[model samples]
Target chain A: MNMSISEIEHEIIEEFGVFENWVDKYDYLIDLGKSIPKINPIYKTDENTISGCQSQVWLHAKCENSVIVFTADSDAIMTKGIVALLIRVLSNQKPEKILDAKLDFIAKIGLEEQLSQTRATGLSSMIKQMKIYAFAFKEKL
Target chain B: MSNKNNIQSLFPILKSSVNNNKLVYLDNAATTQKPNSVIAEINKFYLKENSNIHRGVHHLSQVATKKYENSRLVTQNFINARHSHEIIFTKGTTDSINLLASSFGQLLKKGDEIIISEMEHHSNMVPWQMCCERSGAKLKIIPCNKIGELDLDMFNQLISNKTKIVSVTHISNSLGTINPIRKIIEISHQKNVQVIIDGAQAAAHVKLDMQKLDADFYCFSAHKLYGPTGVGVLYGKENLLNLLPPYQGGGEMIKDVSLLKTTYADLPHKFEAGTPNIAGVIAFKKSLDFITETGLGNIKTHEDKLLDYATEKLNSIKGLKIIGTSSDKSAIISFIIQDIHHYDLGLLLDKMGVAIRTGHHCTQPIMKKFKISGTSRISFAYYNTIEEIDHLILAINKAIKMLS
Candidate 1:
């Protein structure tokens, strides 16, 4: 079954359980991070550094035979995972399609508001980075 | 040992877990976790003693005002200021430094110079940059050595009659370099230059007596010192603060409010501007109490041990290069692994329940100096243990293996 953002978020929220304890919350975050697709090491380079993030991130995308493929990595685990999720949702899709995709799709997963402000900002930077990459790739194509 | 147990007891954050692994919090330079006593003090203020400070004449207000003033006294004592009036409440170190820049910067003439160091946090650097840009003053940088320590010889060469201010950080957030501030202050004094120290990273671990340091001004955030985020201390010499115009014109900072003729309040109140972070300020004292009670010497010792332990372990790993290997480091270990991006390393470490800081650390110039984009930083606090260092070493090795 193909899982939508909402479905995945719901599953995560349900499985993540309570935040009465900080440990549980961190576990849920790490688990969520681990679920993202791992970016290949070859793509990690100077071209993908996002300004304002405490972690170093490299995002690489290509319109390989008209199927957009994104490869990314970060020095942070949660950020890495977050980028993975972004790639899953945005990568291998038409630049215009991905560009027009609503960011609310993330919130619908119930995961958007749940992250810390720093984490949220990091995710936003990643999304912005991806979109920039998409624009560059589209122009090249 | 007494200090260790007391400090551990105060901060329950030490006992917490991160992810599935034991939490190894090594990002102390960013901000420290609040102790239970401080947290309780904050809650108590909110729960029972909630009231507007200073202006209010009600019972609760009196209590709050008293408490707030008491906190001011505590801060004044902490920094060893001559008078509590020298201690102005601020949002944080950033706000206080900005306030000075905005007011005092307006007076700086063209060709004037404000000397800063290579190791300042963005909070300390940006305001001076803006001040120089606005006033046509020159921004002179005191360069750091390859080891990340400030070049005192370069500093001597840079400071001249034109040098109006020489601002620097007491302890670098990214490099963990502990600057020789007394010498810096002495040299600046010789040039008759005002000195503003960014003590945000130093306040918790360093012994700071403003009179002894002889700094014209000192700024530090409460959050970095295990206190609340919204309150900070700005200890300015009375003579200097009085000469500089108020940063923001508003209520509580003025005596008579007429658009035609507004007379400003005296000393600290003149700079305060508006209703301060009352609760945060009052509760902040408890954090100071926790720190004072712990004794900076003991804290330094504990943290040094942790830093040495972590450095030894991390250095042992192959292909690992420790960044900012200054002779004088304050519990911060910033490093990079060859053939692996800091992003990958940070992510893997988090999975292992280790929280570290990564990236350029807001000092792009320093990063450019090193010819690297960023490094992974694991800053230590007194609460962090040797065992946490062990965990971090293991995690780093594992992450390297996984990524490579």
Candidate 2:
């Protein structure tokens, strides 16, 4: 059976809770970043890019079998790692479900600072874009 | 204990911690941490002498006016300007440049050229570009070579009869390359072209003498020199200041007003239109006193040592490339690793309680010249210690290892 959005978020929080220090937490993030599949270069266009970030981030989303899948990339590995965590929580879910998801796991995992608009990572923008995609897909249905 | 310890102790923020670790602030170029004296002076202003300056006949007004004017005098002596009246209070370096551009652009005509270097901060560049757009004038750039030094030979050629002004930074904020302003002034003056020196980066690092430099105008922000924000100085030649139109017309800047016509005030006052940052300006004097008591020469010597030491240590790291390699530099280093991005490095460093600036350093043109997006930069002030540098190196190494 497919897990709910909160279930996935809970799973992530539990996985991150194992780390004792910031270094280990960041190390795990870096590993998650490395494990994420490479996004297609074809989808990496200026239209897909997000501004207001120190590092360049390209986010692309498409609906498959009424489920949304998010693909994203960043020049900075730390940002890429954060993006990986976000995509893992939001992707492979229904568009309506994705749109309704609160995704509070970011704050629970102590990554709330990255959600600040002023942060260089632009993780907040990435999350916003994911929801925007869900909303657009939801409208079509 | 060394005098450095005493100086560091004066800044209470230096003793603070971040993220469960000691905060090693290396972002002095953005803004220096305030000292106890400057902070106290600001507090004392609000507590004792809080009033609008230059207008009221009340006793508090006179006291506020005197303190504000006294700060201008302190700034005049700080930079060794010709007269106190020549020093106009501004918001900061960017505001000073914008004022100059708006007023000075009035003198320009079609086809008139304004020369600037590639390494100018956006503060210096954007204002001139706006002025050029307004006046139908052309902007000329003095190219920076691979090593981040301005091509002086090309600078000589860029100057022409059409060139009205040549503006350059005293010390580059991103690269830390110290431009030869004396030579630039001499060259521009011979051609009857006025020069404006952006002394924002140099004010804290160098001893400025406006007479010796003979630059027509010099601008610097007080915040960079351990003073409060929202306060800066624009020092212009007295006669030249008299010629340009007032930047803004308001209560303090006017001599007399009638229904028919209005006349402006004298040099300094004519430019300081509205009620200025009274508390910040008054507090700035204490910062000047702090710098004077500590000694600029001693600060320079200490910072130079830190720069050299940090440079040596940073060079040893594998895959790290320093962007600015100029022999003459302030206590700043901008570098990028082979694989690790600056954003990643900066985030990890912050987690370890190290604060360093990352990205374009507001000189996107310099980044473009180098064909890179941005760099991780660390700038040092007098209060920074060698131990802090070691900590920064350790943090960087750990961050790199994790990323790898």
Candidate 3:
């Protein structure tokens, strides 16, 4: 599936819009989270742990076809769904493109504001961690 | 006075709305809403009387001194302490506990012990923990039960000859367990051990009588009692207070200072050092007046009714598990849904203008005991109406569906 970052984000926005209420949007998210392929256990180490998150979230990436692919998981199901949204938009894209991409969908979806302060901080940390990974992977490419 | 809605009218904050929904503030266990009279009194103090107490002899100073000292008396009468001098003003509940812990550290030897409870707020726990470390004293905890109540049998065994002081909260802030503090104090006294009561949570719900409770030390925050912040009261039996020595060295705490020697000031002043929160102290008197006029009995009856109603309504929701189920509980309901995240529920509720507390609630040990990260807690005060609770019910139902 070859698509630009914006196309994937647009799909997410449309998918979220289909659900008129928060409940169904969450159900969509939960299904999306369950679809995320598990990262290899060897890569899930203390070094990959992102601090400042209320729940434990681990993200792992390896370069393939000059693009960065991220495999991540969260102890919390809701956080997993939130990370899945990030992975859907930024994963399978070039490291430079992932770095340059503006995640407008987060704001458009009202995910940041709708979250509690702690979880919002967690979301922010997750975004920062993914960007750090993309930038590092970009240097290698 | 009997009308709960009339009592709600006294607080101007209730007149406002949040997120276009009339605010249903169920976080009163964290802090109560301030009445209009208390707010006005705070402004009145800064406007007319704004001088330091005890040291100043000028007219405004004398006026401020009288007002400040009079607050001590009001606090003394409020807690039913024997003497006005026994009431010491500190920063807040945490400050009061730290004050006693530090001073009492000096009084303890290597082998002495202190008993606290697992259900205590961090304000009551950490201070004693640090004190134990500094004084080489052992800190013992009375275990909690499945229902969040402390084990009384274990408490009896914990008090011994080497136990210097036993500290416990009159009510658990997170669990809302109204502890049997009177019995705890009696047992401590029998063993010749001093007792400290952390009344930060109980001050609003439980009408305290320091003399009757016979607690050697009682402390609470003014902000939690619907007064201004940065002010707290410490009620100590005079003999225990006098023996503990001055907590801080400053202007008001000293009688006379020489080149190489200094004499400490008398009872209450010895503990209260330097400039105090004059406006906050005066306004606390007004907050007390609100409680006094409404009658603690009326407030208790209304809250007890609200708790029962909220419990039944909350229990009807599928997958909702109430954390603390003590029969002697106050008006707090901490609960967790089977699979819905607490943060998600809290955020969704916030968007709907129904405020509640979520997370560890600064009682991480209690959360650990339950084997859950956190719970959604809705705590009620006298001003919270049934109509407001209905809004909470509506929001919770919405949250459960969305998160599930």
For DockQ, the strongest prediction is 2
TM-score pick, better of 2 and 3: 2
Q: Candidate 1 on A3-102: residue-level lDDT in tens?
A: 5434444554555455665435544545555666666766665665554455546777778876578877665655665666667667777776666666
Ranked by DockQ, top first: 2, 3, 1
- Residue B234 accuracy (lDDT) in model 3: 89
Clashing pairs in model 3, backbone N/Cα/C closer than 3 A: A23-B402
* TM-score-better candidate, 1 vs 3: 3
TM value for model 1: 0.83
Instruction: List ranges where model 3 is wrong by over 4 Å.
Output: A1-56, A75-78, A93-105, A114-121, A138-141, B258-261
Return the top candidate by lDDT.
2
The TM-score ranking, best first, is 2, 3, 1
lDDT per residue (tens digit) for residues B63-169 in model 2: 99999999999989988998999899999999999999999888888999999999999999999999999999999999989989999999999999999999999
Please say which candidate is ahead in DockQ: 2 or 3: 2
| Lowest lDDT 10-residue stretch of candidate 2 chain A | A114-123
In DockQ, how does model 2 score against the reference complex?
0.81
What does candidate 1's lDDT look like per residue over B42-99, in tens digits? Answer: 8999999999878988999999999999999999999899999999999999999999
